[model samples]
Target: MADNEFQSFLTELRRGSLTLAVLGCLQESYYGYGLLQAMREKLIDIEANTLYPLLRRLESQGLLLSQWDTSESRPRKYYEISEKGRLVYKELLAEWRKMQSSIDSICGEGEEDERFN
Candidate 1:
């Protein structure tokens, strides 16, 4: 693929995972940058600007809860998944497993593809 096309494809890939990553990461409380770091540690590869805005939006939607904490000298907002968010996460996880099983049945080779995407 051309550079621009590859970048666009990558953007598209990230688009689908943003919500899943948010739900998955917020199993523990995290500030925006901490969430970015946690997602990166899990190989989600997201940016802070993108994640912070998403956290705010999800909080507003009641899927997440946030609080401002000043224990570290500078105040930062920490986010955690709400009860509704956990329910959504469980549903999404079930759907994801079903999809993965369907896809796995269609592929006869390459274990890494099954492991990664």
Candidate 2:
């Protein structure tokens, strides 16, 4: 594939995993920037532009709980995974494992170039 096609493929691949990664990150309470930093530390690159809207959507969907923390000079919105989020995460994780196993079977673990064959 050309560079542009490869980049597109990578973006699409990461898009599917981003929600799960964000959900897992919120297992403990964290503010927006903090969560971004944590993901970066874990080598999961999540852009702030993408993450903020996702947080709002997840909260609206009842999968996340958030509150304004004003203890410090600046008030920050902190988020955590709701009980529903935890349950959903568990189900997603199981499904991900099954999907990964299927992929590995087809790809033979490493050389993904011949996977479609």
Candidate 3:
């Protein structure tokens, strides 16, 4: 595949996983920039543009809770996962593990077949 095509495939693969990652990270409260920095620290390459909209969407979906803190010179909106979000995150994690196990099994089978050939 062309470089752009490979990038497109990679982006699609990261989409769902990104949601799970965001939900997992928001177990603690973080403002937009803080959350972005934290995710980057963990080697998750998410753009600010993508993260903001997703935060809004998750908040709107009742999967997250947001509060504004004005103690500092500037006010920032902080987000944390709700109880519902924790439940959903657990479910998604389970599903991801199951999918990963199946993929691993298939790849192991492929390796075995290669050894026979």
> What order do candidates take by lDDT, descending?
3, 2, 1
RMSD of each: 2.9, 3.3, 4.2
Q: List model 3 lDDT by residue over 1-117, tens digit each.
A: 799999999999999999999999999999999999999999999999999999999999999999999999999999999999999999999999999889878787578668889
- TM-score for each model: 0.84, 0.88, 0.89
Ordered from best to worst TM-score, the candidate numbers read 3, 2, 1
lDDT for each of the candidates? Answer: 0.86, 0.91, 0.96
User: How many clashes show up in model 1?
Assistant: 0
Q: Report the lDDT tens digits of candidate 2 across residue range 1-117.
A: 799999888889988688899998998999999999999999998889989999999999999999999999999999999999999899988888899999989868768756657
Q: Looking at model 3, how many pairs of residues clash? A: 0
User: Between which residue pairs do clashes occur in model 2?
Assistant: none
Candidate 2 weakest ten by summed lDDT:
107-116
Question: In candidate 2, how many Å is residue 78 off?
Answer: 0.2
